[model samples]
Target: MINDNVFNGTFQNLSQKNMPFEQVFLNILQFMEKDPTGNFKLMFGTDSQVYSRETKFITGIVIQQERKGVWACFRKVILPRKMENLHERISYETTLTEEVVSLFTEDKKEQLIQIVLPNIYKGASLTIEGHIDIGSGERNKTRIFVKEMISRMNSIGLKAKIKPDSFVASCYANRFTK
Candidate 1:
């Protein structure tokens, strides 16, 4: 139920629509259960677009089992008015990502862990990441806020990724923001 109303309490993917967050969590579990021996990455990120009157933000949740398969979904949040401040927009995106991450509670995290725990000796594992749609390159305007955003993710104990590596935000979620 984490930030349930943010996306109107539903998420849509390739084959599903209006799926509740609980359902999405179950879907991730089922996907991992099918291949418990594989390495997994549970990632969350957000991207936004400002139209003339409102701003639309898309947050993507992805569970990828290394080279095997992936199950993903995204939620959208629309503001009543445009958000033109760069810092505000970027911070809000990170906050949205944090809300998604909060949905994976300790018990839920342990459930995902249990799936690969048995295969740990061999190589199975799970790593959660928060992808920020910003880069450190001098020419990138978002670079200025990279550290602040990464710090926010780290404060929540999530590994943070940016720019070229942050496909969840820069790529997946970005696709729906337009």
Candidate 2:
């Protein structure tokens, strides 16, 4: 079980509200790298109308292999509305969780992370194949299955790809003792 206090939790909003563009973007990246094997929460910002695509992106759908590795399948939808302010940049962030993948505790988290991280994209086509209630509470939980905010967009009818350069531990360093 997660000790609860060790981790600094952040709020994930899924309402019709406005959020800091850079902050929200980092949140998605942190979320992905932390649980690479495959899990996510629907953190909503203002509608695509209010914000630009540069300020928004999605964590990949983490696919799981019954007895193998994990990765990410990331996605992005760049609309014309996005401002030129961030047009020079076109990459999604992904975090890698350190714990190894194993059984129920193993397969779903890291395995899922691996499958999805590698697949995230800004110009990809998506299809909301179905709906699932993953039970990740309002604050996002490591023990909880991923919670998705359904959306299926396309880049000329194809799913774009955000390839991983390498797996990063994503957080701070190793010297601190508990």
Candidate 3:
């Protein structure tokens, strides 16, 4: 965690080294404020992968402004030990997502809403998509836990995405897990 209660985690970009969360958040706010078109959507998600001795978790913040551009920031953590089973792994991943979300205080959330809401009424769009790594398949044991995961996010008022739709976790975060 960034601090006891804040997720001050740092992230990196192709041309940049690690950046503090405060700066990254500021960058997002500036991006919104400078957006003359006011057409942007913000998304957040977490994903994890396991190795023999540890599990790596990554969380991302994405901003999409159609016909303009898109930008993303991410942070990662490594747990020293792996969980016992797929169920445990999936559960732990959810906990990591919750931790990242909790890092956003009520004030920050209000700030984001205030900046993004007006765009919606102006013919723009806003979406908050939570991407989980679990998928439904004949061999996928994690399928059983999908509903619970979705419900967990719903309790916090965020919609959840999985598999193909959950590229933030399944694709973006998966890249850094290695």
- Among these predictions, the greatest lDDT belongs to 1
Q: Which clashing pairs does model 3 show?
A: 2-8
Per residue, candidate 3 scores C-alpha lDDT tens digits across 1-178 of: 3333223357765555579767777777788777634676666677777788877778777777777877787887777777568777787677777766776788887787777677766765555667788887768778999999988877766778888687878887788777
Best by TM-score: 1
Per-residue lDDT for 148 in model 1?
94
- lDDT per residue (tens digit) for residues 1-178 in model 1: 2344445868899899999889999999999999888999999999999999989999999999999989999999988779999999999999989988888899999999999999988889999999999999989999999889999999998999999999999999999999
RMSD, candidate 2, Å: 18.6
Model 1 TM-score? 0.95
Give the 10-residue window scoring lowest on summed lDDT in candidate 3.
1-10
C-alpha lDDT values of all predictions: 0.92, 0.26, 0.74
lDDT of 1 at 115: 93
Off by over 4 Å in 2: 1-18, 39-152, 156-178
TM-score of each: 0.95, 0.21, 0.85
28 Cα displacement, candidate 3 (Å)? 1.2
Task: Provide the global lDDT of candidate 1 against the true structure.
Answer: 0.92
Q: Over 4 Å off in model 3, which ranges? A: 1-8
Per-residue error for 167 in candidate 2, Å, reads 31
